[model samples]
Target: MNLKFTPLACLLAPLLTACGAGESDETPIAIPAYTLTVNLPQTGTLCVDSNQNDSCDAGELEVSGPAGARQLQSQAPGLLTSPLLFIPGDPAALILMHPAARQDGQHLTPSLLSSLLQSRIAEGTPPHQALSELLAALAPLQPNQELASLHRLQEFNLALGELIMAVLTQNGAVPAPPAASSQTRVWPGLFILLPELSRHFANGGDLLDLQARLEAILLQQQPRALVTASGVSTYSDGTDYLLTDEPADHPGQDASLKQQPLRYRKLDSQGQPLPDNASQWDCVEDLNTGLIWEKKLDDASSPRDLHRVFAWEFGPYRPTQDELDYACPNSEAICTTQQYRQWLNQQQLCGIGHWRLPHAQELMSLQHYGSLHQQGGQTATLDVRYFPDLGAGANGFDGYYWSQTLTPSRRLESVPLAVITPIFWGSDAGTDYPTAVQTPSDVNALQLRLVGEVTR
Candidate 1:
């Protein structure tokens, strides 16, 4: 998706020579030529108005579908550059654009198109000035301000584009755009749910009215665990998560899902809950499940270091000698899962004395499948905001945390518990995103995240 840009200064130059009032000039005015080369992820048709006419005539140059750079020339005389119309088949139906960026050979994505439209430009504005305004408008939309992956952002653009295209082609009318919300992170939700909502109402409702109705519906509903949404809003067979209400009204909620994204509350070292927006915390409470989870630290010397690994066994389980050596080094505390649970209880983590290893299903509850879709693959499967330092650790451990659910060992007489591992490397699209399998009880290379029942 490379887009080659030329100096907009020359394109913005006046197309006519100054002449005296009432002076008749018969000379034909020469139109300045402008070249644009667009690189696409896949072969797509591109059209630019090569003539002063507002339409792409048959005689005008059009680039054929090819998954690479496609160049076109435009000589339209105007302050506003002709819209670069593209038809990228499938996922991307139609991408309308103008020279809203000044970079040379930059990859073109729906995100780029989104930023351009965010400028809310007035008609007849010069290309260079529009580019400047676009950048300024895009400053607050960065990932830090509005959490979104590149893939999700592109998906959003495509979804919105197709919806608009369908309305114009099928309904023969263009609905007015919805008013922008004060929240900067609403685009993902808008992109994921707005289309379906429009279709749900037969595409006749005003976008603003629909948005208000949907918001009211969401406000009245509570977050349900089984009905929890993964934030995926597209291509679900008869089951769309976006339409469901999962209690997403709280501030600082993770922007990962469109419906009811995961909600978590942080806790201080003394087991006291902290503010929702607190940047530092020692524990996390899943608002939906009412379970508090241990927060691992990045420091190697800390007992809760994310890199720490342990061995497990059933019926009077104990840590392996290597684990004891690494974990308890020069300390009198025993270094086993049972001992760790007892230690946390003694400390009353989050003011709870029942800290224990989570069951397989409880651990699975933390898995967010939308991560695979939003991030594509080979990324952390949990919300880093609540569970940072997840995924692979030192020496390439698969981040399989030991769970309490036991499975009979085939060869060994002792039963080994199942360990759940979130695929951090890659995914078969998401079919195998949740990897839970039985492992040898004596295996000394596994991680652990303790969880406790929410009694308070």
Candidate 2:
């Protein structure tokens, strides 16, 4: 969508100025004649307030960005996104500063941030990269500040510059560092920046949406696999390995589903597990989804010490009151959704480059929960026999998992406020954890977890 701005309103304030004292002439002023152009952020209806009345009057002036008249309306709303595509963050971050950053006597101002951005831009840094550095600079100072509200780039940059300057000029008022606590807060800049980051991921700009579109074109006729076929004959959960008994070509899968034993080993396409000496971390293949997952237990505590544990985190949004006390599940390790993908790529899990965080629908597809003994009630929503260790350990966040979907609160649109989390557990009536009709992301659930995948 393109918005072309034209300053053509032909009116002035009710009060006027006398042009000549003797003539007692009163001349009405006209709005300035200027031209401005802006690009629409997405495919949406455009309305311009032609009369400056702050309302979209009938046949009002153009409200879209500089693109004159071109606009894109998506029949499929899920495909909405910014700048046309989604990519993991590059070197850019958002830095917003407070309108009044300094005290009565301080000299630091929002302009410093502007200067930093200007210099970075002059040096050829992309706006995004410049933003990343600006936010990074602000992160170290008051890194543990609590997030007070949602943020935007413009104001955030102002506050970021303000915080850095204030920290640098500190007169020994910094608090004593607390005794060791994993609960220490995260960087304020990051806390504030995540929501904006999440917005960039909305409207089909993300990998999930990209894959969905691609999958439609490539596998339209094929059924989507939600329930996995273990191929382990010992456990016949009655899951149909085949939608039908007729021979089928595995268009989505390179390997056919062949029955194996419960003691199945992680394998590459050639069917081999990680070398025997270092088999602690392993993968699993979902014959149903043709996607490989990294077992939740396969991460940290590895003898090899892969840096699997990340800081507890949230994407771009503030939490509600009921969500405030919730911490990342003890069952989970603090890892971001992005790292989950990077690891898959690094390990070349199942030898596939496209291993990614699952979409909400894709993640929920795994939840075919029933009260069968093997399922172990609401506590273990997945097949515990095959994935027996999932909810067992001291820190397992058994019935919850992350999805690569960003959603807005039910009431607001401009605020792309929440990441979708899927509940793998059962009713609260039967369990300790509160049950909800909808599963929203737990802001503190950054380490929520990664399910296992194969060698691809």
Candidate 1's TM-score: 0.39
| Alpha-carbon RMSD of each model | 23.5, 20.1
- Evaluated with TM-score, which candidate comes out highest? 1
lDDT to native, each model: 0.49, 0.36
Q: On residues 1-456, what C-alpha lDDT tens digit does candidate 2 reach at each position?
A: 222222331222124433222233456665443222223323322333223222335753333333223433333322121111101122121221211111122222223234343333322233445456555545533222211111223344444333433332335454332211100111322333434433433332332323233323323211333434422222221454434332343333212345221223444443345543343434554456544555554445541122232322223323443332343234343234454456556665445555555655555544433324334444544444434434322224444555544432231333333345566553421122211212344323423344433332
Off by over 4 Å in 1: 1-227, 233-260, 319-334, 372-378, 409-442
Give per-residue CA lDDT, model 1, range 134-172, as digits (tens): 334334333222212222345334544454444334445
lDDT of model number 2: 0.36
Ten-residue region with minimum lDDT total, candidate 1? 178-187
TM-score per candidate: 0.39, 0.33
Backbone Cα, N, C clashes tallied per candidate: 6, 48
> Relative to the unseen true structure, what is the C-alpha lDDT of residue 127 in candidate 2, on a scale of 0 to 100?
40
In model 2, what is the error at residue 75, expressed in angstroms? 24
